[model samples]
Target: MRQQIVEAREKAAKDGIRVQRARTPAPDVAAPVGEVTEATEPFQDNGTLRTISARYDLTGQRELLWIANEGKKVGDARCTQKFQFSNNTTPRERPTMLLCWRTSQDKSVVVLAVTPEGRPDTRDAVAKLDTRWSAMG
Candidate 1:
């Protein structure tokens, strides 16, 4: 438990990830049985390093904007990204979270999803981001 933190910190430094204050989600021993076990960050591709904080347990297409906003809210981390996963047979195509920063500009976001069956679907996540960014302004 504690060792994971130390190891992650070391890896982050190597990846240029500065965890101002890294906090690992404590095990939810009381959580309902079979509920994704405890801890968040699984949704971030399980990279040993932490370039950014991620949440998936309660995270969804809805929170995409929130996370992106947090990134944009800070400094010029303007170029932000997020990934969402779904295990359903029918997946939604509605672009989510600050999708396109500027259509005129070449910058765009890419959304990738993986199913419980190990299938992959990647698309533009910036289309919705553009909408959310507009609303924020």
Candidate 2:
């Protein structure tokens, strides 16, 4: 995942796209949880814009909060709860779906698939990752 992040940044730079990463501070809780390992990156492949991210919480107690906090960033109304995947979209005119899921007790992943206005949907890529992770556990 770290390698992927580095590659994504390099690709983004090569394509003349500036990647701005937003770091969300963990919520204020009574007790401090263990350290979290996280990585996120956005890049373009075959004309499709994709963002992949993962978070691993040692305590396995903040997965839900992390997901909800991410949803809030996009927009509460656009987010919908599913069995495992929490699906949402950006608030732009042509929204890009953000597919996220908790893959294990302490790990969660999020993916975004974007294409040109008239291009075919690339969301399947995101779904594939979800399926693969779910199967591993």
Which candidate's lDDT is highest?
2
TM-score of 1: 0.19
Question: What TM-scores do the predictions have?
Answer: 0.19, 0.35
lDDT of 2 by residue, 1-137 (tens): 99999999999999998775432344653434444444443434343433333444322233333233333323111221221222233323233333333343455444444444343243454454455456445
Candidate 2: clashing pairs of residues: none
**Tens-digit per-residue lDDT, 1-137, candidate 1:** 99999999999999997665322223552222222211212222332111111122222222232232333322212323342233222223333222222211212222222233322212223333343334434
Query: Which portions of model 1 miss their true places by more than 4 Å?
Result: 22-137
Task: Please report, in order, the local distance difference test score of every candidate based on alpha carbons.
Answer: 0.30, 0.41
- Candidate 1, residue 131: lDDT: 36
